[model samples]
Target: MTSPAELLALYDSQQRLVVPEHPPAGVTFEVTDGVMRVTGRGEGFVETTQHLGLSGGELDALIAKHRDHFAARGEAVEWKTRAHDLPADIPQRLERTGFEAQEKEAVLVGHTSDLLVARPLPAGVVIRETNDHNDIVGLSTMLSEVWNDDLSWLIEQLEAQLAAAPELTVLFVAEAEGTIVSGARIEFTPGSDFAGLWGGSTAPAWQGKGIYGALAAARAQRAQQRGVRFLQVDASPESSPILQRRGFVEITSTTPYIWSPSAPLGTQS
Candidate 1:
C-alpha cells in the first residue's frame, strides 16, 4: 500500500494534472495563489494548487481570480477539492461564492489480491481483451448507452492513451454474439503500487447478471498480473456497495465543486 502522502502525490501528478481533452483556444491553464485555474470563453474549472504551500488568504485570492474570469465569460466552472486539502474550510468559501455541492463519491481503495476473481458472467456473455478497433468501438458504444452520453470522444481518448502506454492499460469487454454488452478499463500507474479501474458499466438489460463483477474481476486480475498491489476507484453510488461486498473498503469521499454562471452567485463578498 502507498502512504497517504504518496497516494495523494500520485493522484496529483499522474491523474488530476492530465487534461484529457484539449480545451479550446481561449481556454488556458495557470497556477496562482494556490489554485489551478482552467479558464475559457464558455467553460472553466478550478482545483487546489499543486503541492504548493500557501496561506488561506492566498487560496481565497486564487478562487476570487477564477470567479472573476468566469464572471467575464459567463461560464460555468467546477472546483475539484480533495478531502486532504488543508484548511477544509475552503469549500465554505466556494459555497459563499455560489458553487453548489453535488453527489460525493466514495473513494474505495483495496489490495488487488483482495478482489474475488471468480464471478460468473451472464448466460450469453463472454469476456475478452482486445487491441482491435472494432472491439474497442463496441465497448465504447455500450458504455455510452449505459452512461447516457455521447462517448465518441471518450473512446478516442482511451485509444490514444492505450496506444501511448500499451503495456500499462487494459481494455476488457463482455460480449455476446460479437456485440459488447459490458466493459471496463484498468490503467496501470507505473512505478507505483496503484492501478485504476475506470469507466465500468453494463448494459441495462445485462445488469444484475454478474457482468459487472466479472468485468471488475478481470481488471483486478490484470492489475495483479502487472505486479500492482493496490486498486482504487472513485466509485459511484451504485457500484460502491458492490465493491464493499467484494472486500474493497471506502476510504474517503470526494465531490466535485461545480461553479457555473448558470447558478446563483449567492453571498459573494
Candidate 2:
C-alpha cells in the first residue's frame, strides 16, 4: 500500500521529468511568464505552470497571451489543473478568464501488485498486445466509437510514437469473435516507477461484462513485468469506482479548462 504523500511526490516528480509541458513532434512548445504553452494542429494548451503568483492584471494579460497564441492557430486550448497546484487560486482565475471548466477527475494510484489479481474474461473475449498497423487501426476505431469522436489523430500520434520509441507505449485490445470490442493503452515513463493507463474504453454493447476488469488486470501484469511499481490513472466517474474496487486509491483531483476561439481561424463562421 502506498501512502498519499508518497503518491503525491511520485505524481509531482513524474510531471516535472517525463510529462513536462514539452512539445511532441510537430508541435510548438514555449515557456513564458512561468507557463508552458503548446500550439499545434487544432490543439493548443497551457501544459504546465510554475511559481505563478500573479496580480489580476497580470493574469488577464497572460490569458490574452494564451488566447492569441491559440487563436492564431485556430485551435482549442485546454489547461489541465491539479488540486495540488501552487497558489491555490489558479482554477478560479482560469474560470474568470473565460476558460470553461470541464469534468473533474479522480487521480487514482495503486500498487501494481494490488492490481494484478486474476479475473476471468467474458466468454469469447480475447486480450492481446500488438503494434501491427491493422491492430492499431482497429484499436483506434474501437476507441473512436467509445469516445464518439474522430480519433484518427490518436491513431497517427500513436503510430508516430511507436515508430520512434516502441517500448514507451503499449496497446491492448479485447476482441470477441475476431472483432475488436474494447481497448486501452499504457505509457511507460523513462527513469520512473510509474506507468500511466489511458484510453480504456469498451464498446457500449460490451460494457459490464468484465472486459474492462480483464483489461486492467492485463495492463497491471504488464506494468509489473516491466518492473514498474506504480500504476496511475486520471479516472472518470464511470471508471473511478471500478478502479477503486481493484485497489486504486484516489490521490487527487484534476480538471481541464478549455478555451476556443469564437470561430476557428480559416473557417467561415
Candidate 3:
C-alpha cells in the first residue's frame, strides 16, 4: 500500500520545480533561486521547490523578481504554492507582493491500477477519447456552458499540448444523446511516474450522475495503458470529495496566487 506521505514524496521529487526540457514554441523556462519561472503564451507561471532554504529577506527579493519578470511583459503571472512548501509563509508573501489568491484546491493522488476499475456511467452516456480539432472546440463549448465562463483558453492549451507531444496528451468527452455532457483529459509526464487527470466539467443537468467519476476512470485507464504508476488531480472543492471517494489519497493543498501589472505592489484585485 502506498502511504500518503510516500506519494507526496514521490510527487515533490518528480513534479515539483521542474524545468521544461522541450518547452513548446513561444515558451521559455528559467530557474532562479529555487524557483522555476515559465514565461510566454501571454501568461507566466512560477513554481518553487518544497524546501526553499531562504531567509525572509531572500524570499522577499525572490518574490519581487517574479513580479518584475511578469510586469515587464505586461502579462499576469500565477505563482503556484503548495501547503507543505517552505519558508512556510510563501502564500502570505505572494499576497503582500500583490498576488491575488485564487481558489484553494486539494492535491489528490492515486495508483493507476486502483482507479482503473470500471465504473458505472449514466444511462446512454459514452466516454470517448478525442484528438480532433472539432471535438476539442466542442468540448470547450460544453465546458463553458457548465462553468458559465468562456473556456477558449482550454481549446488553445489542449491543442498546444497535443501538438507539442501527441503521445503525452489525450482528451476525453462524455456524450449522451449525441450531445457533449462532460469533458476531461490525461497528460502523461514524460519522465515521471504520474499522469495528470484534469478538467472534469459536466453540464448542470449532468452533475452527480457518475459522469465525473466515469471520466476519471477513463483517464486512469489511459494512464495505465501508458505504464504510468499514479494519477494526480488538483481538484476543486466541489470535486475533491468525489475524487477522495474514488480512492485518491488527499496529499496536500495548493493555491494559485495571481498577479498582474494593473494590480501593483502591496495590493490585490
Candidate 4:
C-alpha cells in the first residue's frame, strides 16, 4: 500500500517529466514568464506555471497571449489548474480572463496491487487488449456514445500514439456479443513508476454491472505486469466513489478553464 503523500510526490515529479515543457512532434510549446503554453492541431493548453505571483494584469495578458496563439491556429485552448498549484488565485484569474471553468474532477491515486483484485465479469462479457485499428475504432465509438460527444479525434490520436510509442500506451475494452460496451486506455510514464487511466466509459445500459470494475482490474493487472507502482485517474464525481471503494484516494481536484476565439475576453458565455 502506498501512502497518499508518497503517491502525490510521485505524481508531481512524474508529471513534470512525462508532460514536457517542450513540444512534441506536430505540436507547439512556448514558455513566457514561466508559463508554458502548448498548442496541438485541434486543441491547446496552458501549464507549468512557475511565477504564480504575477499580478492580475500580467495574468490577463498571459491568458490573452495564449488565446491569440491558439486562435491563429483555430484551436480552443484549456488552462488546466490543480488545487495544489501555487499562488492559489490562478483559477479565479482564469475565470476572470474569459476562460470558462469546466467540470471539476477528483485526482484519484492508488497502488496497482490494491486494484488488481480478481473480479468476475458480467455473463457473456470479456475483456481484450488490442492495438488493432478496428478494435480502437469500436472502443472510440462506444465512448463517443457514452459521453454523447464526437470522439473521432480520440481515434486519430490513439492510432498515432500507438503507432509512435506502442509500449507507452495500451487500450482495453469490454466486449459483449462482439461489440464494445466499456473501454479505457492506460498510458505509462517513461522513467517513472506511474501509469494514468483515461477514457473509462461504459454504456448506460451496462452501468452498475461491475463492468467498469472488471475493466479497471484488467488494467491494474497489466500495470503490475509492467512493474508500474501507481495508477492515477481524473475521476468524475460519479466515478469517484466507485474508485474509492477500490482503494483509490482523492488527492486533489483539477478543473479546466477553456478559452475560444469566438468568446469575448473576461466573459464566460
Q: Which residue pairs does candidate 1 place in steric collision?
A: 76-260, 77-259
Q: For all the candidates, what are their Cα RMSDs to the real structure?
A: 4.4, 4.0, 2.2, 2.7
The sequence of per-residue lDDT tens digits that candidate 4 reaches over residues 19-60 is 532233576666666677766747787875433676667666
Candidate 2 residue 252 C-alpha distance from true site, Å: 0.8
- In model 4, how large is the Cα lDDT of residue 106? 100
Q: Which tens-of-lDDT digit does each residue in 91-173 have in candidate 1?
A: 78778777888788887877787774766766778998876788888877887887788776555656666776678778888
Best by lDDT: 3
Among all candidates shown, the one with the greatest TM-score: 3
- Model 2 clash pairs are none
Q: Give the clash count for each candidate.
A: 2, 0, 0, 0
**lDDT (C-alpha) at residue 154 in model 4:** 78
Give residue 269's error in model 4 in angstroms.
19
* Local accuracy of candidate 2 as per-residue lDDT tens digits, 1-269: 56988888878767542443333467666766567776654567685553477756666667667867777767788888888777677777777666788999999988888778756888889999977888778878887887888887777777766665667788888999878899888888887878999989899999998888888888999999889989999999999998888788998898998878773222110
* Alpha carbon lDDT of each predicted model: 0.74, 0.78, 0.84, 0.79
Q: Model 2 misses residue 30 by how many Å?
A: 3.8
Winner on lDDT between 3 and 4 is 3
Q: TM-score of predicted model 4? A: 0.90
**What's the CA error at residue 244 for candidate 2, in Å?**
1.3
Candidate 3 lDDT over residue span 127-190, tens digit each: 8988888888888898888778898777777787778777777889888988888898887777
TM-score of every prediction relative to native: 0.75, 0.87, 0.93, 0.90
Candidates 1 and 3 compared: the better one by lDDT is 3
Q: What clash pairs does model 3 have?
A: none
